[model samples]
Target chain A: MDRLKSRHLQIAMFLLPALLFYAVLLVYPVLRTFFLSLHEWNGFAGSKVEYVAFDNFKLVFEDEIFWKSLKNVMVVMLLSIAIQIPAGLFLALLLNGKWKGIRFFKAAFFMPVIMSATSISLLWKFILYPGDGLVDGLLMKMGLEDSIRAWLADPSINLYTVILICCWQGLGVVMIIFLSGLVSIPDAIKEAALIDGANRRQRLWFVTLPLIREAVAINVILLVIGTLKIFDNIYVLTDGGPNHATDVLGTFLYKEAFRNNRFGMASAIAVVMFLLGFVLTLVANRAMRRESLDG
Target chain B: MTNAKVLRSSFMLVILAILITLTACGGNKGNNSSSSASSPAASSASSEAASEAPKEKVTLRIASAYTPDHTFGPAIAQIIDEFTKQHPEVTVEKEFLPVAELDKKLTADRAANNLPEIFIIFPGAGTADYVKEKKIIDLSEYLNADPDWKDGFISGALDNLKFEGFPGIYAAPIGAYSTGFYYNKELFQQAGVEPPKTWDDLLAVIGKLNAAKITPMAIGASESWRSEHLFTALFYKWNGAEKAKGILSRALPYSSPEVIEPLNKMVQLVEAGAFSKNYIANNYAAEIADFNNGKAAMRYSGSWTVGESTGPNSPAGFGDKVGFFPFPYFADKEEHKDSWMGGVSDSFAVSSRAEGHQKDMAIELVKTLTSTASSKLITEMAHDLTAVKADVDPAKSGKLIAEVSKAMSTGKEFSGDISAFEPYKPANTKLYDLTQAVLLKGITPEKAAKQLDDEVAKSK
Candidate 1:
């Protein structure tokens, strides 16, 4: 009993500082947001905060724009997981080599990932701008005038424009993760697959992919969360304009809290977003697990 | 190591990480210049004051969105310098936040219970709210005590900033500005067109410009604010003050003729190719460049553009080519025929947080900055309208800002933006969105107007 007590005491001492910070920073703010969501608050310190129960949540439900934002988030999330993840993995596989320029290509592809979303959005805005943009100008010069697009200004393509920029900026992280996982795979296992007459495609689809289940799962989960919470790209590029057609949950929450001065509504949106992220992560993990097992 | 040892080690590392994070966060908070009054100047000034005579020293932090290059920036600096020189007992620390970041910084500091002792307040909803919360000081007592100061203020200037049914004034008026069509005079001359005398004249000018192959007008709706401001010029011309009041009072729906009429005219402009080609994708940078280089005949812009167009900010000879004109009113209506959209804009408000001697010092700072002398300086340098009546010669103000400033004075009455009015505050953002939808997305004006009315109803 005394030895057991000593072991427990040792554990508590090591954990106390971390627990304190976790509670203060992350846990406390989340709980505070939940509490604030239950009231009607203007977000001003001295302003009267009224207890409105679930009225804020009711307001959120009635917000058509908020729902549109969630739908936009879903579109971006699907693109991120379905398209971006595979694209990243494809790049990782292609670039996983010992060559003079392989490292250079890898570094170049990852360059945007290190830059801020605001700068990336502005750069793309200039490049994608119709009539005057580099892309459109080049197309016009090449007599591909029909290919010209208003890019971020058009309602139909603006959200996708933002999503693609996000993918371009974020591709490096997924690629780097997959590259580390690929490089870590043992030579023996790959040799064994080759000895069994497995070709490059078969080895990739069978042995190499199945081996990196953990990496794919992690990357997918990360992309889903990031896509759902994306704000900076939308803010700098479109600002949820062209008739709120490009609004995402993050921008919606920000508009409510900062611009509209409705903190309660913003908090409710935050909580709903949190739940969506949690459930989606769980679902993604399950799918990845099942797929890995099947492989 | 065994599994338990590894687990224990990782947890210990987590503890160490958390400690470092906590310390870092605390360290960061200590460095929060957001709420700090810059000290060195105040310290040195106070020491100098201490040498002269032992007086009860009161240090006040003054904050503003004005950069030193802004219209009133030099006047503001002069006020602080002169005040400190006169009263050695007072040390005023200045915090200069650019206009874009002022609201965010103010709110953050307000939440922290550490707002600067005096600050420039944006004119609109939040100003009223701040007054109600006692964050802003009531300035009527000071104004009333000094009839010179009271009479010196432009009529309706302070009253324009007052909260409804609230006693006294909460802000001191600094200046006024307007938004209108800033055209290239040389382009108009080359095209053999003068400034439009009426709405039809304006359209004819646009037609002539187009016939001459000069891009008739430049609008960068990609930026959105340009569109909203253009909507401001159109709406205020049609709605005027009384109709605007009626719409806000709910006596008239926004869908009424007053709104849809102007909305339709804007649509007409777009349909006529009066705006730049690919205007939907062209932003401020492109619009300004095209207009400055004479690729376009005109661009709808505001008073601030006058200073930039004529001052060092403009391209070489851009000022020489640029000219401003008020948006034309209805062809038939005699009433409000010369009415233009603009009114008493930016103001300085003392914080209620300051008490006793601190409050007195703050009030003195406001008086010095807004005095007639300071107002004239603001007019001549910044090319803005002074809220205090001052004789500003066109030659002194430069041709462009001077012309607009003259228009601001001669206009029948100053028509303010809908959002700046108290009742329209709740629906301001929705109004901007509605304007964007109507103009950019090609939604029907009637539908957009009704949507705005519905937004107001819902908010109520």
Candidate 2:
């Protein structure tokens, strides 16, 4: 019992710094934000705060712009999960094969992921500009004038344009993770699947995908979190405008908090955002856990 | 522990320590700069007094939200140099922030209770809120004693400097500007259309231009503020002065027939292809470029465009071609035809927390920068249309400024933008979005009007 207590004390000492950090950085701010959300005050407009008791949250729920932003966030999440996952996995599979210049392709594919979001957004904005832009110029040259439209300006395509840019920038991490997972799968398992008369697709499905389940889970969660918190891309590209059609929760929160000076409303939006992320993450984790157990 | 394990643990500890130290040092530097910037006037005054005996040097820090090339920068530097030269015992350290970042930084400073002794106050009903909060010092005491300072300001400039139920001045006007339509004279000539003298004439001109396959106007609606400017312009025209003021002050509903009339008109114009294709995506600079490049016949903008059009780096023919007009009013309403949407005062307020000599110095700085001579110099250099009555050479000042001045003289009343003059509870963002939606085909004028009404009702 004495030995056990000593060991426990040592473990607590080791964990103390992390606990202190979490308390100061995360827990404190969240609690303070909860307190602030109950008051109606512009963050800097003196101390004439009126305690309205959940009015701010009620206002957020009733705001049409808030609902529009949530829809945008959902669209972005679906695009990231549906498009980015398959694209990244395919790239990882291609890179895993032995081929000339494969290493160079791997490095090139990862380059955009390491670049700053602002820089990438700016580059893509220029590329997608309507007139005198690279894409438009190329289309004009090919006598495809009908095909050219102001890609970023069209309400029908603006959100998708932003999603495509985000997917391109984030594909690197997903690719690298899957590549590492693929390498870790024993070559003998693939060989055995092939000998058992499994086709290429069958081998990949039966042997490779099962082995990379943990990597797939990590990639999905990372993509979800990243997409949920997306700000810089949308901010630099559209600024949630052209009629508030491109607004997402992050942009909405920024406008509420900074521009309108409605700190309470911004916090409420943030709290809702957090709850959505938390619930979705739990559901994903459970599904992945069940999948692993079945295998 | 094994040797490898021990070595790895030590490496990890060192890395962690370095990270902590870096973060702490970064945080400390940020805090130091902010504190120094905030309390500059106090520190500068104390150091000046300390150096009166000729024993030590004095240094001052000035936080400015103007870039070095901006007109305010040179004006500020000149004031600081003059003040320091008179004292002979002071030095100023200046820190500048970009214009776009100014409001955010000021908001943060205000929240922290660490505002600079002197700062720019955005002129609007919002300034009233700051006055109510006691963030700004009442300047009536100072202005009353100085006749020269009081008289030098343009007429009606000090009206916005007042707080509720009090006649005392709390801010000073640096300059004045008005928004209006800028049309290409060459385009009008080429299209064989006369310059518009009324709202109907303007619509007729737009119709002619659209028939010729040229967009009548180019506007940047992506930025909500830019879109709001057009709404304000139309509101002033459609609702007339008294009703417009009532609407802005929240005494009238946003969904009133008067408010919806202009939106319906704007939507009709959009359906007729008055604005450039994809106007909602273009930025302010890009829209300006579009008009300058002859792709659009007109742009609605402020007097700031004068400098850009006539500057040395401007595209060829812009200086010779660009012309200005007050956005047309209804010709049928003869009594309101001359009333122009304009205002005096780009204002600044002193922080109330500043006291004694620091406060005195800030007031001195404001007076010096806003003096007639300084104002003239800034106006001429920036190609701005100054509100102050002064003899300026038309040939030297350029045609745009002359045209604006001519209109200003003939104008009967100067009505300010609704959002700028009064506080409506739902905020300007909703109105701005509604206008853009009309322009972008996202909503019909009737639907937009109803939505505005809903927002106004809900907000109350």
Candidate 3:
């Protein structure tokens, strides 16, 4: 027993540095943020800090801009899942086989995942620039000027434009996830399915897809969390403007905290964002687990 | 294993833990100080404990929002270098961040109580918070120490830096900027129009420009400050500055017709197609490019454009063809005819966190930064106005800069930026959003005004 205690103490000594770093950097800030959410503070040294429990959350709830940002993020999350998954799967399947220049094609598909979001947003902004930008210029050249609209200016379609750009950026990672899943499938399983008289569609539905359910679960959960916290692209592209038609929770919280100096309100929004991502992820994990058990 | 071996290993582990804890503590102390030797306050205390050492080398850190290529950036750098040359014992560490990035960084630093020893205090609302919190020390005593430096500043230039109810001088002005319409003279002539002097004249010019197939104005609503500047010009032109202060004090509601009228005019401009096609999507760079490229007839911007429009940096090669005019006023409201939205918008302040010798060094840095010699460099090299009176020869400066300089001096009254709408910044943000929404026709002027009023009320 004494030897075991000494070994345990030695192990803890090894883990102490990491634990200290984690507690100071991560745990402390999170708890501090939670504490800040319950007070009214302008985030200034020696400034008045008033404790008004849940008032910040109440204010956030009553804010129309907050609701609008929430709705915009929801749209991005739903559309990212709808578009990125099937498209990523299709691309992954097409590129999965051993073919000529398959590596090059795979690299091309995954390039944007490694590129900076700010640069990508800037490139897209230049392309979608109104009147003289590439898209409008191309439309004019093709005599399709009638269909051209303010891509990043119009409140009606600005959010959708940003969402599409986000989808473009996020598609690479999803494709890579699905590609890895496809590669891990055994040759024997596919051969067995084929021998059992399974057609291409039948094999995909019965054998291939069932095997990649784990990747899909991961992709879904990641999309949910990633889309919910989306900021840089929207910030660089529209900055939650054209009258804030494109604000997400991240940008809204950031503006509240940094721009407005309302740390309390921003902290509350952050807490809500965390709780939301947590609940949705748990639900996705449970659903995936249930499906796997049923299969 | 023997017990002696286990005991020796345990002793080694204990020493390791001690080392880790010591390193962590040391790291924290290092981060809080400009140098590894000591924190600024701690050093100040120690130095006070001893007699002043004249030969001691000191490091002063300064944070500012000027890019190297910015109009003021080169001039500011040259001046700081000159100061360091004069006093070899002083070492200046300069941090340059873009304006938006600097604002956020300063906010975070303020919260952590880790602001730099010396930093630029943005004018008006930007200085108010620092003053209220006493994050920045009062500069009156420092200014009084040298009458020549105090007297060098242009009259009323320091007025805006002094916040109401806070008595002492908290900042010294460095740069003065004014907001107005910058027109392409060639385009206006091509369109058979003159520089607008009144509201009716502006409308007629817009009509003629539209008929000439020229975009009348280039507005970038994506940057809300562009629209906010326009709104400020309209409000101050119609109602003047006194009433603006009244509105801020809640003596007048934003929904009042005097305030809503500016929104109505903004909506009218939108309805009349006075701005470039899809102007809402354009950024400040793109908007200015439109005007400079002669694609648009006019733009509403600050005097900073004068430097860029004339110097080698001028992208469009328009040269002297760029002209300036104040925002047109209502023909009947002649009281505010001479008024312009203008003031010293950037200044220098020493952080209160710097103590003893460091505090004195920071004050000396501020004085050096705002001295007459520095102002001349800024005016000549940057072609921008300084708070200090500098003799700018017309031969060396462009016609545009000369005109702007004349307007800065001759204007009867000046008002603050759109940031002055409320002490609560979120309400000011809401005002910016509302102005953009009105420009985009997303919301009516009346509704936008009512919404702005409601936002301000909520902040209170």
Top DockQ: which candidate number? Answer: 3
Give stretches of model 2 more than 4 Å off: A1-21, A45-50, B1-100, B387-391, B421-426, B458-460
Model 2 accuracy (lDDT, Cα): 0.75
- CAPRI class assigned to model 3: acceptable
| Candidate 1 Cα misplacement greater than 4 A, ranges | A1-14, A101-108, A122-150, B1-59, B68-98, B122-126, B282-287, B422-426
**In angstroms, how far off is A85's CA in candidate 3?**
0.9
Off by over 4 Å in 3: A1-5, A46-48, A126-149, A184-186, A196-198, A293-295, B1-52, B315-317, B407-410
| DockQ of structure 2 | 0.23
Who wins the TM-score comparison? 3
| Candidate 3 lDDT over residue span B148-254, tens digit each | 89999998887767888988888888878888888998998899999998998999999999999999998777777788888888888888877777766787887
Evaluate every candidate with DockQ and list the scores. Answer: 0.27, 0.23, 0.45
Tens-digit lDDT track for model 1 on B1-460?
5557656766776667666776877677566533233343453465455555546689989778677867567767876788899999899888887764686688777765578888888566657777766677678878998887777778878877777768878888886777778899889998999988677888899999988888999777776567677776776666666566665567877778887887888888887779765677777767777777778998777687777667655687788888888887767764667667777777888875565566667788888888887777777777766678776767877877767866766687766666554254336777767777767755899988877776676564
TM-scores for all candidates?
0.86, 0.87, 0.91
Per-model clash counts, in order, read 0, 0, 0
* CAPRI docking class of candidate 1: acceptable
